[model samples]
Target: MAAYVGRGVHGQTVRLLGTRVLAGELREGDTIDLGALSTELDLSLTAIREAIKVLAAKGLVDSRQKKGTFVRPRAQWNLLDPDVVSWQVAAGAADTFFRDLAELRAAIEPAAARLAAQRRTDEDVVVLRAAIDRIAASVRGTAEEETAADLAWHRAMLAATHNEMFTRTDVFFAAGLSERDRLVHGAVHDDPVPSHSAVTEAVAAGDPGAAEAAMRALLDKAETDLRRATAMNRRAHDDHERGSTA
Candidate 1:
């Protein structure tokens, strides 16, 4: 489907640039000067019109008979919509994206571990043991195999808890598991599961405190891994930038 650019496209381009420049400061009943907006963006009126139409459909802006366009309230924003995230990133509003993802982990992971400890079945343990064994066997092999085993191990770990949330989150992360796999996969020597296994065993044995502590250790490892991955990405990005300039 073709996307609308705003009134003859000029309006759309003008409006898009206006909204981004004044994204956070929008208020109802605030009249925008179409001429001034065009001058500021250095774009044609046709382009601005097209940009406005897109933003209007997105509910970020409203156009009235004569009141011009105004920003919508925050409550009306569709935050979880994928397009919204993409727009924010394009607009340079995602500085804390990864940090927020980790914050959600701190909120949800420990409880997931504790529940797995208390609810794990004997069969679940056996399955998890097999997954860990697969991971160990994949050493010095293909990264794809290591990633599959890592994802399987996480699913097995979540199985110990029987909590839907853990499993649901795992599903989301598992789909993107390869986001880290190519970098960290097959790089194992010491097992990542000793701490994870302790949590599962404690859960199966009905030990709450030990289960929680063990899960914490497993999560701590994750945080460390996440940091390492992020640092690597930054270094890569910097190298790319330098190479481009050179």
Candidate 2:
């Protein structure tokens, strides 16, 4: 997941506070002492205020004359924001993030595949094929490479739909998907190449029903892989805890 922060001190301040809030170091409804933060971080009041404004825009914090600046409830956060999603994953919430991402993909990708099959141009087919090739190649490469290829493949799928709204949704969920891909790619899972190839072939053949079904199958496998990965992570953590206590 990409870190989107302002340049220099402003960006640093926002990242510091945002991570604290997302990581639960600063709980919801907890008031922020901007003056103390400014002193602590050695940033000017203007820089701290600017960071607060940025966070407020993302629904992370709010201020009033009497109440002062405070972290908002999680329910009020713009969870769909990529930066927020990135921070959450960074805060070790990858399991929850992956589960949410799978649910969202279940809602979006199958429909997108169907639309892509119906609406895709020859150029779209080329892009989709190239993306699949990248995915295949990256499977033997580094995890980050595989994650990037996976992201490109999904983006290509969405773009092929030729629907503005569907394409725009990519920005909101890309971070979560990036984290998901990294985890799944690094875990013990089935070969993603064949599943991805199936969807691309269906899209290229302009078979809407086949495309949707293939994408659904792909998502089913993805969810399974995610669950497996999460379970493995939990077991590893439990083992570490036991060893530490021993």
Candidate 3:
């Protein structure tokens, strides 16, 4: 159901795949074939047209006469667009697209964490600590409460990193972070307090390495849980396919 939700346009599926595509390197003025993509995704030309138009709004695809739609340079893509990220997430032909994103998070968040630790001010520490405490408080609160606090904590981390690029992207990350936990992390069964607190303490203490490692630990645990869920889903999908064929 989840995988299919990201299906292609024009009778194809819609997905909420996020992050991986926009982060890539794009050259200046790359031409793309709407016709080809339509055939590949088994969507109609109309569907492809509408989809590309949306991409164009995001500065991802530019359409001109005597030439079909073309991919804009990487700098132009609207990384913050929720639909764009979801589409990117759905565009993958292999399961690895998501796994790679998870793995990439594991690699990058740590470095970002380290930076935040070294650069964070006292106020930043207070904000992050407060967010962490809120997560703890919310654990016993309603589902919506926990979700909001968790995202707040993540945004604080992104801000503490003090990287404009990282900070700017927080809305996107915060929107998808918990969903990633739910889909990839087996419903976030493990408590997030311990996971997030380590990050806060390290940053508060100005321990760059520890901050990075702590952030990595949280993501690594997520990756582990995500892998489990993905494997389980794949096996179930394969069995379904086999049974249908049989």
Candidate 4:
């Protein structure tokens, strides 16, 4: 399973098949043929099964005793799964995925910030400050570095809450948050350091209301940036399609 896990034939099959389902090449209720996939991909049946298991865990497919494996409805999909989030982005669902992620953040982060302000330990503050410093350092660096730092900063914020449920969802937030950071960074020219710093200061001050307000403002700005970025992407896609036909 480890050998078949990443960038290998098994993993590639998982991504290809996941992308197809996400892109609507395979719609809900559509069944897949194991034998056909094996022959077409020139992969062993065991490898194919391993790939399917990965997809299944993401709520993309279900297998019955004799019914084979079928794509699940969109409502059944676990969008919070990092792998699913990554597949959605890969399948050109960035606008929808990011919008949903922004909504989730709006609902969760403010509360988390408030809780962190109330419950944060000295260690939490230290880690949060370090993560913020990392973000500041990456402002003039590569997008990848900035994205990594941004994710770490948010993860640290969640950890500061001292709530297992909030911290446990960190993995689910990983890909979506990283993708959101990438899009917002590419679209907006504003320096986000001050906004982030505000949250840090509020939390460090043990001011719940102020921390919550700062976090809300940060999320609000992100949503605004995401809307502008999505609109630009839509226009570009339309123009490209028109050019292709012309």
| Order of candidate numbers by lDDT, starting with the best | 2, 4, 3, 1
Superior by lDDT: candidate 1 or candidate 3: 3
Residue-wise lDDT of candidate 3 within 73-119, one digit each (tens)? 76777744655545554444225445556665665678888999999
RMSD (Å) per prediction = 7.9, 3.3, 6.6, 3.4
lDDT by residue (tens digit), candidate 4, 98-161: 7677777887899999999999999999998898899889988877799889888998999999
Measured against the true structure, the TM-scores of the candidates, in listed sequence, are 0.55, 0.81, 0.61, 0.81
Can you rank all candidates by TM-score, best first? 2, 4, 3, 1
Q: Give stretches of model 1 more than 4 Å off.
A: 1-95, 164-166, 169-172, 175-191
Q: Residue 143's C-alpha lDDT in candidate 3?
A: 62
TM-score of 3: 0.61
Local distance difference test values of all predictions, in order: 0.62, 0.87, 0.67, 0.84
Q: Considering TM-score, which of the candidate structures 2 and 3 is the better prediction for this target? A: 2
On residues 54-170, what C-alpha lDDT tens digit does candidate 2 reach at each position? 889999999999999999999999887777876787777776777777888889999999999999999999998999889888988888899889999999999999999999878
Pick by TM-score: which candidate is best?
Answer: 2
The TM-score that candidate 2 achieves is 0.81
Q: What value does the lDDT take at residue 237 in candidate 4?
A: 85
What shift in Å separates residue 123 of candidate 1 from its native position after superposition? 0.5
